[model samples]
Target: MPDKDRSQRVSDAVHHRRWLILTILLFSLFVVVLDNSILNVALKTIAAPPPTGIGASQSELEWAINSYTLVFAGLLFTAGLVGDRVGRKGTLLCGMVVFGLGSLLSAFSGSPGQLIGFRTVMGLGGAFVMPATLAIIMNVFERAEQPKALGIWSGAVGLAIAVGPITGGLLLEHFWWGSVFLVNVPIVITAVIAMVLVVPDSRDPHPGRLDPLGVLLSMGGLVLLVYGIIKGGQLASFGSPLVWATMLGGLLVLGLFVRHELRVENPALDMRYFLDPRFSAAICAVGLAFFALMGVTFFMVFYLQSVLGHSPLQAGLLLLPLAAAQMFFSPRARLVVDRLGTRVVCGGGLFLVGLTFLGFLSLDTASDPWLLCLLFFCQGVAMAHVMPPATVCIMSNLPRSKAGSGAAVNNIFRQVGGAMGVAILGSLLSTSYRHGIEGHLRVVPRSQRDTAGESVTATLAVAQRLGPAGRALVQPAKDAFVHAMHVTAVGAGLAAFLGAAVVLAFLPGRGRGPCADDDRATPGSPPATGRDEPDL
Candidate 1:
């Protein structure tokens, strides 16, 4: 056969195999995202002293979580650049190997410090895996089918969220806390095997010289910023000099990094991509949406476990409605977007998210479990609408060669926004709880009063030791947390409302579908545009 005929046949074969490749990609993504939430249920277990646990103190436990966040968020941009330079498939496979090794080491860690170090290694691998998955999808699928493909990809994240906690709970019930980390090994092996057999390799055909300075600056800035955010949330206060100074320093360094990118001959990421309204607005919307979602989730866990008297397993099970709604709606969100437009779909979804947050005001200790489930379902539906459409906007605006960079930007906003939410909203929750419980603390000794008022968990522990006398403190602690959660809900709701307003103002209305103007563009070239329709 002629060369042209042979090439056409190969293209058809690749197209046919795309869905199988997507399945493999989802498996890779699942393990990476699963580690993030799975560790939550294991924190209490890890805090116990002796062979059963790590004997990590509260501060040490906080560090164990923060270490992962700090590394993952810090390295995401550089990792994306690496994926674009090297082959995405190779980067993904290498990342999974590193991740599996880290998990294996973490499972057998002897000290809190060792666990923290191992978690950081896992974060490094995760940074590479996350962006490469999306980048590969962009390369594999045509523009016309990108939205549907991305929707399925987004749905997998929701599935991971539900599975993470439940899986952790089940493992802890039967085995050691390290089982949470150990579980990742088999999943990684399966994904790696599948990937090796089916996934195609792709990279930037015109990748320029390396930008070492850009890498250093971005890593330093993100590390300092995320560390400060984690510290503020842990302390439940940003008033400390350590928090303010570190965050400010991060901002300053990031400003310098941006300026350098603008002037550099071969930038790691093109600074000009932010000039596109669709790209900028969509990323901002993602950030704001995550801010509200993460903040609400942070408090909701405490409400379920501490206030509602649910076991970790029961709490995980109760969250099923939320995940179920996401899995049901995320893949279908594009169909809604096709009718109503990206702007309307995403903005309305955010508005609904705000309403659900406000709905928390109706709940108390006596509220029915069914009511809670209903609220969670509603919130999940809302988020399903926002994430998929907004992601489509961000990715569609970029050329295929820049998909890794675009994915990195999307994740950066998510990480930073979630950090801010947990810090600022958490501070509000802590302050309000302390104020509400201060009056009741007089009954306890002065030394224990401060510790008791620190958190509902501390108060419950204190109350349990005092037996009948301590029983008096239980009702007050629960009431205070419920009230504090109400206050935090209002703050989170406002963030969602702000996100809705942003998309409505800046995102385009009904017009051409995403990537319509650029569907015919060849690799390594800028996207072509001539359509009179709206940008997104």
Candidate 2:
């Protein structure tokens, strides 16, 4: 056969397989997003199996969700590097196998500790898969086609993020606690089969030598830093020695990793990317965007269930609007970004998020459901603009050789931001709600004092039990929740303001001289205005 014919055959194979591979990758991505929130609804069920575990504390339960993402963040950079050296197909298949085993383990775990252990294993799988997906997508699609392909991918995950809470709620209502973990099995099995058959193998032709020291540095540093961030609230009042040591130690390790990367022949994650303004700006935006975005989502779940007296399923169903609206708009996001550019579109998104947060602040018990849906819908619209385009900017700005590493770094920042979001927003709400509840109860008349300790449902039960007196006290509980919601929304609004400020200041403005409408990924080319941003 002629050389051209062999090349043509290879190209044909990739072209046919791309869509099928995309379907499988999207399913894998969905597992990560779904599991992130699915267990949230099952917490009550998981804790209900026995006497001692029947009423787990909030922190004990939160760890179930936090542990997965935390471990995933720590392993991401190292996993991506390993995948690039090994064939992406082999790496992805291995990840799928490992992840499937974890799901099975989690489904059968007898205790929270055992479940967390399984989830940590699942996070290792996620680290393997996440960067592999992005790099594989970039490789499979031609440069011109990558933005649209990535837009679809981003939209899929965004949809999952919005829908996961609701889906978990629906499943938990109808099924057993283990059903949440069991659900991933069929989807992942299908994904594994499809991926093995359809996804083409790809690897870096000049892959760097493995750097074990770099891996240790990154993993150790990330573990310490993220754990510190997650535990910061508990340590805030006390300022414990471990807290200081871990945080400072993590910083030192990260610094050492950077220095090693700069000096080594083949570093695990090349630290040079920090020099690129476009990449740097894109990464910073990833962190800040999730800082506000996930904070709002984390609170909304609680607000609906705890504050508004909605059941877990009902709360999940209500958030269906957010996912639904984002899906409705996601396919068109890249077009909007192409016409408007990342800066304008992303800035506009932040502004809209700020507006929607204010809408949340104004919500009261008697407020119409449609009004709340509208606010979430607005948030969805903002997300469609921010997520896909921002990701395209980050990936496209990188050298082709470092695509996997770039994706890993971007992913790490997002997860870190999410962890921070939960810690900060959760602490504020817990503190504010407790204070508000206490104050509201104090003002309650002696007549209705006894009924105040009752659950929201219990209070409703006694509304008829205590007649008009019990009914009057019901208003106080509602008032307290609404006031706490006000504080949460204000915090989200301020977070959005801060995030948007960073975008406006650092991200290149629209209508510039050379980079004005540029989306090219030309290698070794000079940046616009003759300024050099460091290479990744």
Candidate 3:
């Protein structure tokens, strides 16, 4: 057969397998994202002492989550660059292997410090996995189908959000705390095998040289920043000189990193991307949305388990409505955007999210479970609208060859925003709880006051040790936590509202669709006919 005929046949084969390829990519993405939320249900268990738990303090638990997020966010740009330089498929395979190993290590961790370290390793692998999946989708799907594909991809994240806690709950019910991490192994193995068999390899033919300094600066800046935030939370005050020093230093380094990127001939991340209003607004919206969502989620788990007296499995089950809304609406968000425009849809969604956050203000120790579920579902719907449209805007603006970079920007904002949410909102929760419960701790010994004031769990633990006397501390601790949650919710709600304002002001209106032609083009790109060719 002629070479032209053979090339046509290969193209047809690839075209037919695109959806299959997407399924495999989603599987890879699922496990990476699953780790982000799976720990929520287990945080209480992990905080327990001895063989049952790791005895991690609230600050340590925050670190456990943020450790993964910081590393993931910090390495994302470099990982995207790696995916573009090496094959995305290879990057994905290697990332999954590394993630699997990290998960295995994390399962057997004997201490909170060790768990934090192992989670960081998992983040490194996750950094590689996240961008590669989106980049691969960009290459596999045509522009017309990109929105649909992205919607499905976003929904996969929602699915992970749903599955993670429930899976963790189920495992924890029967198995040890390590079982949460251990569960990742089989999923990783299955995804790896499927990807090896079906996923096509793609890379930038003329990739830019690696920027080691930029990578170092980014990682250093993020770690310092997050550490400072966590430190402030641990101390329950931002007045510490150490907190200010680290935070300021981090900002300085990040500023310098931006300046360096602008001047460098071959930059790690092109600073010019922010010049696009759509891209910048969309990225910010995503960040802000996750900031609210993750922060609220961090506290809600505690509310369900500690305050409301629900089991881990019960808490996970309660979140079903939220996941259901996300899975149902994420894929259909594009349709809404097409009808109402990006600005309107995203802004409206964010406003709804803000409302949902404020809804938490109504909950107390005896609040109706149905009301809680309604709020979760509404928040999930809001998230569905926000993420897909914003993501589509960000990715569609970039050239397909730079999909890795585009994906990195999208995810970096998400992870960083989430990390900040956990750190900042968690600090607020801690500070508020301590203030409310401090005076009541007069009954407790001075030596135990600090630990008892640290968290609801600590206070309750102290109460439990006091036997019948401890019963008095329980109601006060619950009341203090509720107050703290309300305070955090107000902050998170304000953040969401601010995001709504930003997107409404800046994101593109309905005048042009997301996939409008830009200047960048592949050298030998085929013309887009606004439709996929029929499969062979």
For TM-score, the strongest prediction is 1
Please give me the total number of clashing residue pairs in predicted model 3: 0
Query: Candidate 3, residue 140: CA error in Å?
Result: 0.7
TM values, all candidates:
0.94, 0.86, 0.93
Candidate 2 matches the true fold with a TM-score of 0.86
448-516 in candidate 2: lDDT tens per residue? 644443333323444546666555656666666577668867887777767667666666545552221
Q: How far off is model 2, as Cα RMSD?
A: 5.8
Over the stretch 1-536, how does candidate 3's per-residue lDDT look in tens digits?
Answer: 24444333235566688899999888889988888788889888998898899899877887888788777887887888778777788888999999999999999999999999999999889989999999888777765567788888988898788778888899999999999999889989999998888888877655568788987887788778767766766676778999889888889998998999888877777788787777889999999998888888888988998899988888888888888898899989989888989999999999999999999999999888899889989988998898888888888777666778779889988887887787788889999999999989987889999999988988998999988877889999999999999999999999999999999998878876553354233223332322212212
Which pairs in model 1 have colliding backbones? none
Clashes of 1: 0
* Backbone clash count for every predicted candidate, in the order shown: 0, 2, 0
Give the better candidate number (2 or 3) by TM-score: 3
Taking all chains together, the TM-score of candidate 1 against the true structure is 0.94
